[model samples]
Target: MGNEYRIALAGNPNTGKSTLFNALTGLRQHTGNWAGKTVSLAQGSVEYKNKTFQFIDLPGTYSLFSNSKDEEVARNYIVFEKPDVTLVVLDATSLERNFNLALQVLEMTKNVIICINLIDIAEKQGIEIKERLLTNRLGVPVIKISARNKIGFPLLLDTIDRIVTGAIECQPLVLQYPDEIEEKIRQIEPHVRAIVGDHVSARWVALRLLDGDESLLDEINRLITLKGAS
Candidate 1:
């Protein structure tokens, strides 16, 4: 058996996320419910360059704010499970809209790769994406591909391999909020860090708290209680 890595596949609905997942996993995948949650996620494993990559297809969500059960499940997995790397798929034709989710994922974790799918279609529509510019702006590797045609799969898999093996480093873009919000985040982040102690992203927890995310607060409290019991 080769070394194994867990990758969380996330994107908005109809971004060809499932198509990419199917392409990578082929018939070696299974669908199951997340622990204690009714939301089901498809999981599969594939071997690349003598390494095993296990991909978990998270529910398609526009935002990570736990507005719905599916969103909650996806957010919790990324925050708590801390996959080795998150591969966020985006529709090349609708790059602007797809960026909402991609940016959210970047805020949560630095280990991320942006996969722009359907590039061929986008080109046909005369939509041009400057890949290098995007990489510079996002501070992460961005690969263009057409999942349906299996175009650029080699580069995609190679990039994933590099990230998982630490051959490539990612410094995800961090958004700057209004001064008032920044001040609040600064105030609460230390307290959150004290409690979570690097178990999760304290800054993100602080943001959620400021947004009055009751679901996240409950989750934090539950984790604290579990830690105390342990």
Candidate 2:
């Protein structure tokens, strides 16, 4: 078999996320419901530089806090599946609203690339994004492109290639919470790490637990049970 890499596409609704997916995958895609969930998930594969990149288009969500089924499915996939690289699509016209999800994803995984879509629209509105500054701030590769116009796709693909092949290392920005929350995370993170043991992000899990996320507690117990059975 040839080398294959799994990439997760995540973004808010109406951010041109689906357009990007269709452009890359074309006819080689399928839509299906997530296991035990009614929310639809689109998946496709595209060949790039002798490598197969399978893209899982996660349900459009504004946040991964599991407020809805879409959020739950998207959050679970990133937290559990642990794709080779997570491509977070953002709307250049309204980056402030989009950054909420981007920051959450950064907390969950370090392998990420922030793709600023709809740059053409933002440019028409006299908005100029400092790509280099954003890249340095987020500590990850940030590419600006108009997915509808096929602009900057070559660079996007090459960036993905580099990330997948370990040519480029992504150092995602870590968020700092208040001192009280940080103390609680410090106390819980070690226990989470002992349980998950690098299977997932212990710090992220600790934050969820602190938020009183009962669903995540169930998931943690389930993971422990599965490991015991294995």
Overall local distance difference test of candidate 2: 0.92
- Which regions of candidate 2 fall more than 4 Å away from where they truly are? 32-40
User: 144-223, model 2: which lDDT tens digit per residue?
Assistant: 99999999899999999999889999998889999999999999999999989998999999999999888878877986
Candidate 1: tens digits of C-alpha lDDT, residues 111-183:
8999999999999999998989999999999999899999989988899899887899999898899999999
User: What RMSD, rounded to one decimal, does every model reach?
Assistant: 1.4, 1.5
Taken over the whole model, the C-alpha lDDT of each candidate is: 0.91, 0.92
Clashes of each: 0, 0
Superposed Cα deviation of residue 45, candidate 1 (Å): 0.8
Q: List the residue pairs that clash in candidate 1.
A: none
